[model samples]
Target: MEDLRIKHVSLELSENQESHRTQGFSSAKLLVVRRGAPFRVSLQLQGRAFNPQTDGLVVRVLLGKLYVTMPVTFSQSGSPSSWRAYISPEGLDPQRLSVFLQAPASAPVGAFRLLLYVLTQSSRRGYKAGRFVLLCNPWCPEDSVFIPFEDQRQEYVQSDSGLLYMGTAMNIVSRPWSFDQYEPEVLEACLSLLQVSPPHMKNSRRDYLQRSNPVYISRVVSAMINSEDDRGVLKGRWSGDFQQGMHPSTWSGSGDILVQWARSGFSPVKYGQCWVFAAVMCTVMRVLGIPCRVVTNFNSAHDTNGNLVIEEFYSETGKKLHHSTDSIWNFHVWVECWMSRADLGAGMEGWQVLDPTPQERSKGVFCCGPAPVRAIRDRRIDLPFDVPFVFAEVNAAVQTVIVRQGQALSFSTDSQRVGVLICTKAVGFPRPQNLTADYKHNKSPNSTLRSRCSSVSEDVSPRTDASHGVSVSLTLDKAPVAGEPVLFAVTVTNTEAVAKVMKEHLDAQAKEYDSSPFDSFWEAHSLIKLAPLEVKALHHQIDPALCEGVAGECLVNLAVVLEDVRTQERVLAFEEFNITSPQLSIQIAGGDSLTPHTKHAAAISFFNPFSVPVSGELTITGAGLIQGKVKYSMSALRPGGRVQQQITFRPNMLGAKMLQASLALSNNTIIRGFKMVSVNDA
Candidate 1:
């Protein structure tokens, strides 16, 4: 018997216009439709037309475990022009089959295959017709998560530049977090990551939500991306020493991370920090058709004890002690997913925060959030899924303590210092949107909404009243440069009527941008009596040797306290600065434009201004422009010498491509350079 052939398959968006059409049946030609939405598919069959009453034609669709069969309905009068005119050897028109399918609301998301079969009086045979994909409906009101239509398109559908905020409020660091989700490798990696069950979840059977819920998928992704646990896909090791481990700059996009994880057979890939983890999570969520965006919280608090207060103990000379459990990060990056909370209930639906950084544990697992952003803003600590944890991250009080001779001399609490700039990528654009105001209530006194979440006030440390007589100001010498001294100047002015005796204390500490201060780089103490209207300047210099471990970017927290000897009143000032690594200049040799399938060269130059020789490795990577790893090692570079290297690559894809070069020095220093090149089709 001859096998049946499918001549054409067309997807009808409406009765008036055709949307997608393919000449033959194939999985590559997919028809995408939302669940609960009705879609029509038209298939033109090769060979002589058959009488439906006698032929018994039927179409069967298979999606995962779901299987359904329906009778083929054809209209002879409204058939396609080619279908009505084409005649086979038997002198009859070819058969045209059209079927309208309505995917059930609970239908699982997956690829659906269609098969055409005929049942005669004796035997039956089926031929593969076509395949399509069904996605959950974000438009349906009952299932919609209330994300803006444009956000759903730009954030969830399109892969492009994202924003990751770093550093503290005083020194904000903003950089582009590239997703590159449109790449085939990235999509495959996302699908693969979703399928891998975490260690704790292995024994427990997964339910429908566990398998298909966006919240569950996002939570699992958070844990799997970081290899902190046995089930993690990437082994995360943070080191300022680049020669000791993988550099975060080595990977250009999330696709690179995912591809590496997959190639290693789902083993822990390499390395990732907060920003890297958040960026990769965004890529996975977007590829899985979940609306997601990266968010950065400046002065983010890590309140380990559920008390919304981050305590910092400082020595008299101004060294931050690491004895306390509570701490504050310069900045922390995480992702927010938009989804309806069928598990949590109605009002909780919307943007849910998911942190893949693996800093803290939620539900005995090394994962955080699926915590509703609405709950955080509303101070709904009673809600499930780590609501209190996320709330403290954005609305915690920062307490600075001055301890001398094993005694607590003074303490100051600032409620507004933590969570300074909460930012995310602007909807429909690459720029950042400062969403700080959305997460916290307005500080204005007359604002009525400010008190609605007043229940959170009980958990925070009490704020001290500001002393009106004395004013303190702290300023850094310049934009902090690595391998150089950082000078901090503290100026105190006394506006009181009489001369006052005061003791001055200053503390400078180097800390991880996403965690608490490691150790104090420098500290100073002095006693000075300033007369009325008198101003005094106290300066402290942090040596470059003390900051040697400061790799790419280091966070320095400065605390200055002045105590009036007679009254015992203290004036406090705190400042944070981001010390950036020395930069390397990368320039396209000729220009920034290239033709597809052509070779191009770029020059990377860095000046060794230090007395010691510098030795490191240079890594160049580009998504569509370069194929594989291009690395060069520099053994030694004499002091006061300028070194230049050339890198050549061939472009395979045409578009705007970014070529990034990172120099990881053996002295625990890393600097990055970037150049944008446009590739045109030849």
Candidate 2:
């Protein structure tokens, strides 16, 4: 009898999932393949031919203490949710053999160990079959997270760079983000993210078993993205002050945040808002092979008390008062992950909204959703996983009222305001692709919400007063640029035939971009007389001095209220606008083409648009182009002066990639720019 020994084992990662849908992560030194799909393994033996009749072979897959052992089957049948394997029919040499291993479509994702046991008549021998990572498989029809389109899978799961739509819907600002899934420490950070989850730390067995379901995994990830639940990845702050930690707006990529979190002993990264949380979650989800996209809902509603309605109130001077717990963000961001919702039935499968912003709690945890978008569109709030809360985010009616010392003078229910222009980065393009139609049923996009306010205590419905014949409107002459005076006009019209004398009050306030307005920085009052059916436009300007001293991204809330001298009736109108920060112009050399492993010249320039001297740090980062980040600190730039710096550009990968530069000013203001270039194989 000869002692059979194994000499070499190879997991053919390149032939299986490497070129399937994503980047070069599949072709790592260790095997990283998607579950529900079969991966090939070749075993080279030094001894005799394997006898399938009398001898036995068992393959075991393990994660921590939980593992499954499945024998190599000769027959072609088994359950899709069960582990199975077989000897390849091709290349059946006596000593060398090829084997195919398949895990259940719903396999727990993460690093896994494989062991092969050979059983003889008298004894058994086991061999370590090498290590590999298992991710969710969207290409496999049997996978619960299976997405149908190849283009979608490429954009959602493979593309490391993306655009997060921010600002108002009408004036959209697409923020560039590097998901950086393939970065050195990013994948490890993702795995670490799961390992540090509450469930995994509590009961490892139950957590490993539940990871197979995307529903459960998404919920856990959602809770873990924010620090309120456990020692999550990010600490949320809606306040404008970021002196204690990094400002949310300054972070342009997820790798820096994730790596810092992982290196800091799983401490939550400070100062993340909705978009930051959503973008980071998108990175984690895509790394785990879950198709995901960052979605923006402009005029997004955050309903408190869960009544399916957001209440707001305005003062006689059109000042939005903080009277209610409910609020409507100028824009809200969340991730829509693609997966099959087996728990909710058939048609519910598709893009499910998973918010990691930690605004509302589900089942006592600060996890917003994995709520089916279909269920939300149908207004089926009776479903599980905070469907009602999501339903209100998109379809909730906004009831705004004007209060004059606690009395509701007027109110309007603008159903079309909430969830206006839901969108994400377009597939294979850099522009925005509107997904608003998917969230709203038979709703017109042109409809506008005219009223604004906080919450009033009185129970009131929208009512039109016949005696109130004055129409008021506020408009910005142009988009307010940083360091410049804000110019705007207020138009007042007497809709009735009779002449009227009115007292006009205009208030301007600086606020955090993600939350409600605070105190007014500037206010003006005047008496106006309007002739019958005549309209008058009053021009106004807000000096730059008023908007200074505010930290982080700021939006100006300009509101006007008119009081009729004849009947004491008031008409209100307001406009919310953000100052467009000056961009750090990033110019790559040679126009469009860059050769891999070669040095090229690039330039980052910024013209100080501020009246005061500016001092800050500039950071340049590219995923595959360079290692971490190239940063520089500026001494100071006088007003209206231009500063240009040269950067040595080098790319290490072939394909299209983005080079981004961001300038974080001493005032906590951040401005960024990016340029896409193609890398030639030469």
Candidate 3:
């Protein structure tokens, strides 16, 4: 008898992808399927029939040196972490065979090489079948990453477009993000992330074996997102100089960064800050079928020494001094991934904090967490994988010090200053959902924090208050918008029954979201004399052009420092004023209804708000609506002038898509807008 030769194999891509919930992602085109799901495969034999008696059909799945072999048969039960295949009764033939292969829900996830062997009593012949990518299954309950809610699965695991909260807690800015996982370049890049990781490169078998656990996979991904230790996906640039690469704020989506990294042979893409790292990490996690969301923690702290305290020094003149290595960010963005932590026990599951911003080292690398939020809330400092680091980020006390010359004249700790508000994009909405309660035991950390982190100190001293005969308050008249002057007031009240005289210094500086205030661009110093119990509201307006920086978030760090001329007692009041860019208007040529694969036209318009002429590039990116990005260089538009760009987008895939536009100006001001378009199937 001739050897059993195989002619061809069919992966049934359409049927498998639809059932596996992987069809929306571009990975499905390469036969990507979720584990725990049964997918049909057809085989054509050229020589002889597959005889179950003398000839055995064996299926092999390989990942690097690690491989799993399963003897193909009917009704065979095995381990959940093992592969399985059964003869399909739907369609069967001697020359042609249709079999269903089910990857164990707990199987290692990544690209797998499929192979088939036909063994006879006389000989054994093997055929190289194709390869398919495997992802974690949020649909299967047996899977540790299983998410029960349908809407959550859709938002976290499937939705390609999202919002990343930025700016300060007082003025929350909802910036749109295109995860773009459906883009072909993104899918390949995300998988390539696993391939280029240090662990995968050094020990492929061990890395492949570790993929069975979501925790392991998350930790690996977090470490691979920044290029500090490993030549990872992004290179962090915190010094505010992005000349080597694109500005971190210029990135509107992960697709661009991922494609650039993969196409450059895994070269680290230049310039990623907290949001960029967190956003890209979110994209990778979601593409791999893990539920993830980008979170912004306002008043976040970076305790370099790990004492759970961020000491900030201010000159007696009210200028922030770089005295301590510790710092408090206006806002820090990170991601929270959903998974079951079997290793940490039952209650220690759900959303785990994962920071990919190349912060301090964790376990000898620069990736933070898989830190259980539950553990952080319960003050479980000894938990694994940098729980203390993440806990400090949201709970660290702010130690404010007023330095005179080289001496620290006064110091005070505000337990509730750091981690004032923690939030993420609300499910099925663009608004922010406050997660502050989840991270903090109470809004006021006075007693709660002191009880927990023996590290978090009490008020060592106090700023000038009623006891000192004066109180100061800095208030913004209205939310600051880009192109419009920032109007705010400093309210100084003499609470004492006697006349009081004080020296007031007001400072306004430009700052990045994750950085401290730079140089003061605007300042005012004046001496004021107040009668008994007199209240004074001093109004000030800052020119829009004066505060805008070449590279930084459109925010103004406005501070008012007061010193009693008689007593030398001082008080400080500050406000982080974020400049909200005017939203671009997205208008569909003919309402919102759309059809797949059909060309459609839309117009994006922006009204110049500045007193000076502005020029920039408008980039439009939509995953299902368009491929990659289309950029148009806009000429200078006079102040208060309106400019609109007409562009055509063809729906390549059907589903909901966000049509997003970002206008990056020469002045470093970024204006953005988006429209959600629902496309029907063809």
Candidate 4:
């Protein structure tokens, strides 16, 4: 480990501008060898600015064919105090040379000398670069194999503790040595000297605690800074909304307001059904200065029937009732917060749970974590909070015909409790109380009704002039499940000037139409019209047995057709959607690579997202995937393990190359990612 000499040679730069600045030569060479041990030498060069043409630069040592090049151009510009350069061949003979170089014929010639030194770098951790001493004894035979420092790596021992080294020279070394001449024990001992081990527990408890409790585990998990500086567990834009007055508190409050705003309506929009709730909770906690994030995921929650009912009511009802389910939760976004002992005391600590709609709290809790005990945050509170509310206002008018289909429909009112007027053409159907009270001045105010409300009364003969018409509407009582039969009821209203004529118009159509045409023909005329209203009621039994353990999703389609003859317009009203499969989940495996430059194989698994089983191919994709087969592997992954195949990269060429590949599991599935590697040629 000692007696390795190092010398700093002067660098001479000739005062010539047009000379070939890059040419070089060296003035001397050094020899290193031991009689009975391995003959090896390493040079550590520290070069300075020099003129290559006249003051040439180059080195030839050990009377061997090995040459080290020094470009005058880079040497003059490089400011590093020193640079490392080594020469060693495992099985090569040793010799020395008075290495020197003359400038090429293309440029001016001058004189210059640059700094240089030689050293043998130890293979141990924190082993400073220095000269190595010979280990051979003179008593050894002359024919003994002489190995170069590079070749002697085989002689270096592998330490008991596994540690891979990035060699300064011999870079293509492989593992599990195949050469029979290699001595594993000697190699291990040599490596043992190179291995580094930190101190064992000085004060067992204190040292143990230092390792047990990380200095910044929570900080790493909840930080929102860039990946280089921050090691947060959760990902995505959970932290970016703090600006624009969108602090967690403001955002959460706004979401809570939306919930309260949707309740009071003839058709209340179903808002606040997804992240709305989580947004509120996350905001409230964030305002309290807690580091929190929302994560969406899915799991099975047992239903009252004790059968797992993948939650579908939230989405179906949202879409059908409100005309949209855009911001609905996909998996189920819940908030995770970094909690401390003090926070825990508040009963809202450590990833608090705020599932407000749980019917069976235990069942909802079942979906929280695989191991329910592990998922518990704090003790559950069975008591209910003030129910958040929302509201809406709906307005409408109604008209009726006496002789034809004597059905009634309602319209919005300005009364204490909003209610609609029902209009019909039947002879003895009582007048609507609200309407009767308005028309107390006369039992049948034909002129007034014609001018104001567009009413149709039945009494006189048929006439050419009629007052008004009616419209029919169909709407849903609530969202229904897919694959279920639905019962929809309708409401009709009539308003006309001439009651007798309105009756006659209905009579004419009644004789020509069956029950089916009654709804349609009434819708066709504005004079003897039908204002339709309908509510949906669905009843269907879901047999899990039908799915055969595979996830299945069904989309229910509903349509109501109304034909208007006066306007010649066909109005089709319907809502079509998938009852299940509103959420999707994917599990990726076998995607671990120590470094970016290396190509690692991986497998991706796609799930139905819902508790139901779905059949589909999974697509896998990766960056720096030099070669591979299959995107979504059908192989079921082992728990806590991965299903994977190998991808290889041979760095035969230098520079950066992108490694990317994709898996096309099913027609709709695709997964991808990438890695990087760097190589140096000396």
Candidate 5:
């Protein structure tokens, strides 16, 4: 072939002339195709034209070391589109060639490179070509073009990982967060989870198929990552009791969980809540080439019965009955897998909800789903695999009953409170996508279901006559910070022409922000008689000592109740505040300059400001900076004690690296310190 040379190359869709590539071999062009779909590539040659029968021209597709070759075909019929014309001897244009390729139904999803070669009865030399990406057809068997681009990015790409914030007031307090899944440990952890096989499954073809199937893989991963099943890897615990006194965030990423599990011989990995389980499952799904994303539902209901109602019994004093059969978490995290559900028939495919939190039983196991999000959105209660259970998580009506001793005092139903904010990582960006409205149906005004209900109503207490009026207002001292006292003031005014007597009650309670009623951290009541148009103010202080036992984040409720002695009418004023723990600062005492394979010393200092002794362990970890974990045992430091600890580590590689040190306090507080290091060969 006299050393075949090429000048330019371009790739366009088989049906259109719109080029996917303009100019360059530096970056490979992409061809998105589904299995059993026709994929064609056009190649233009500017140098020479060779006979197809004598001097064979062929195209090769390569994935890793595996390659498939197809012969270049020619016909008198010109190119299909207006932009592409046939190479003729009379014209001064480039020679044209076309190659058609087919991806079998069993082909894996990944990137494939294309190459062109010419043969003259003996040696085959390189011509010109590029690469294309073959993705699993998410819309196959049925059209699903409505799936948002954000869902596609979150579901398919491993590099774009997600984070689900825990706690009830997450939406109000915690800002949107994302995770780093490109870490080497995270990738390794994902591979390890896939390698784990079910107990009953032998190494048969069905097992192999199950390993590759996203539906089956997601279900297995949901169970295996948690120790609820024998095939599980980590023990699930909601209580904050951890072996190393580590907060859930101290473990870093999903890779940390996987590595710790394997290091413990596949035993439960310390402690994991719902968010950890969902995040780990996302890593596994993305690593195995399945589209997956982590989702967070605030005020998630755990309805015991099939009825879409979460009932709660609260005392007249606003204390929730703990023995209720049904419960609602402040927030719950789970994963959604995108795949075609041939098992459930049409309209059941797309995103399937999979909960790994070991909440309920499904098919004789503790794993939650593969339940279609579409089914939940459509309110299909009759579907199989815990569809009703998931429906209640989002669409359940919450019936709140206020009881005095044993009798019900007041009752109200709220439908919109169950799922306040349903969120996932936004597509193409590292932010939250609120899909709350997607799971909720628009109800007519005449519909029996009420989306929200007030705790107190005018019907419950007779409305005061306009002649004898009263108004109430509540205000906070400031934004509540953890380990600090929160003060609230309630003011009641008599706006009547005549003298009015009022009975005033003030209550301040610290409640779990999710669904259940919380206990009163502090309370005060005062009865006062005010003159006409007279105003009175009452104050309540929630001491830091009272909230010291409250770990992590919680909500403070300040409510004032006033009753007209003569009219028997009540006026209520309420205010809610989200109190968050103060951020702990870890001062890193070291310079940023460093060399590869050199030892570095850094000192971490923290001060104990509380009266009680504090004890915990400090963990230092980094990707390319340190080889493994560096730990320091922190003994009980007395009140007002300042402790400084020195640690040494050796850098394994070189670059701009981040070293993180997390102090997991015994009181369930996580303090973090970060330092950026620049490594040089010198």
Candidate 6:
């Protein structure tokens, strides 16, 4: 911190005509006032051109503690414009004043201005502006210098956070509303065939697992039987051998064959089985209205023998890779779908899971629920632009990209040379149930990943070809084996070789995209927006004529529409705020007559789930505010205190009135509720 300092300042004025006015420090003899002394000061103008009759005047003065003051001034016959002010010792520290005298509207038009003189603890100074020359002369000779105001240039103010800079508008193809609309019928047909029960063959024994999609599961079961018999399409199977398969569908009980099938599909070489099985399952599930898709990745273990494999390391070295050669990880894929209890059976109660091919290895799947996607948009900067390659941007034009199979994407672009790439890696069934939230205080004492982990693993970058502008490549390493961390990286570089590294970095760090008001700072930047509002003194009941006991509740549907104050532009499509008014549990309260005016006290609460604080009015149409103090509190919120109260709404009488509540939030924060409850009115 530095000590406050006051310095002497000065000003000069000139007119468009060849006349000039110079005052302060040159002609005005102003006395310096003491820091704490009582005194008196006055400014008496006397120039003939300073006529209040012809030139109207405005005077402003600043003195010590008095700061600055502006007042209109009228001219006199003897005294041009006189200003008298009494100053106590408190007012004598630093005194300054500004005077503006303009030529009267009735007077002849020309250049006109004002001059101020001051004395203070800092220093003595003079300032001037007007059409008159020095010595109170409006018309001196043409020898004086005059500078035009047009020569001055203005500078723009810049924002510190880089927020003022407008971001590039991303160009995307106008895609259909849902991913299912773009999918081909072939995928579903394939799935349908897979779901059918197999036809009985001559001398073929009946299989026990009868409930499954018999046709598809049976074909797979038959393949296993053939493999076990030492004669198969890909290779002959042998007893107690790694190449053999489990005829799970032929087993009577809930056999472990599924788990075994899952394990068998773990190898990078044999991963095609997993992909095909998953694709078929997804189609079958979708056909059954299960809403399914597949997600692919790599695993590093073998089913028959517990062996380790690393593709990158193995490809380089001449060492013979041990165990059965099956690509389970490279082309790995699994099914994801929203399933009902009837669809998944009794044991699969919570979130849906992948049906293990060999009826085994299903227990190892983790993080399989709906992983809430928190997208943090970041632009790339400081990228090398010298590399030669085709570049294009890809994004799902709709609000969200729903994962599905055989979905055709709409592609549009401005650059003819750049190719748009879309590589459907796999479908993922991320159940929202898998998410668990934990919070640490801002001041917690814990080291980052660098300080905690013994050795850091390097990132493995996937390769892309020259033709594909945006395509995904998968690489599954098997050496480290199962239970080890699997690293995946996706990079997109334009023809200029400028990669969105910063955006990628931000994406890697983002954990959740909370569509809460507490998160958006009242700004409509994200796709999803949620806000909570309150309804007070809700009258709950069923019509007396139709009622038995009090059972029905009054429900109110509310919508919030956000608008940009600056642009006055409304986001018509997705910009909306909605919350249902709390169900008022109205009771009969021992009332038999229809005219009974039963009293009730209730508070309706709403929350904003976006990162920004939202502001809008709540129209209290159904019920008006009663006579009482209005308050706010939060409900069902994460750890950090994230709630605030808006202004209170007090009604004169009990009638219908629009109770409007405006709300806003900080960036990356969410405000949960604005609860409204009325007290004591039946």
TM-scores across all candidates? 0.78, 0.91, 0.93, 0.20, 0.63, 0.19
Error of 1 at 385 (Å): 3.5
User: What is the lDDT for 409 in model 2?
Assistant: 90
By TM-score, the best candidate is 3
* Deviating ranges (above 4 Å) for candidate 2: 13-23, 26-29, 48-56, 73-79, 240-244, 404-412, 444-467, 548-552, 680-682
Better of 1 and 2 by lDDT: 2
Worst 10 residues of 1 by lDDT: 446-455
Tens-digit per-residue lDDT, 411-504, candidate 6 = 1212111111111111111011111010111212222112110112121122222221222222222111111232222222233232211111
RMSD list, candidates in order: 7.5, 4.7, 4.9, 30.5, 10.4, 35.3
Against the reference, the lDDT scores of all candidates come to: 0.66, 0.81, 0.82, 0.22, 0.60, 0.22
lDDT of 5 by residue, 1-682 (tens): 3434455566564442122111111112234344334455565554456555566666777654556665554432422211111223333223555555555444543446778776766666785466665433443432121234544643454343333454442323332222334444454445445455463244534544344255666677787878776646567664445665344555655657776676666667767777777877776665544667778887789988868788866554434566568887767788888777777888897788999888888887788788888888888878876788898998888776656558765555666667766766555443456666566665221211111111111111111112238776776665555567777666767887678777766666666544444666666665678888887777777777776655455555556566677775655555545555533344444577887787778777777755588899988776666656788889998877878878777876444455666677888666655555666798
lDDT of 4 by residue, 143-257 (tens): 1111223212111110010101000000100001011101112212211111110111134223222221111112211111111122211112332233432222112122223
TM-score of 1: 0.78
- Clash number for every model? 3, 3, 0, 90, 5, 97
Better of 2 and 5 by lDDT: 2
Ranking of all predicted structures according to lDDT, beginning with the best and ending with the worst: 3, 2, 1, 5, 4, 6
What's the distance in Å from true for residue 422, model 1?
1.1
For candidate 4, the lDDT comes to 0.22
lDDT of 5 at 17: 14
Output the TM-score of candidate 3. 0.93
In candidate 3, how many clashes are counted? 0
Residue clash pairs of candidate 3: none
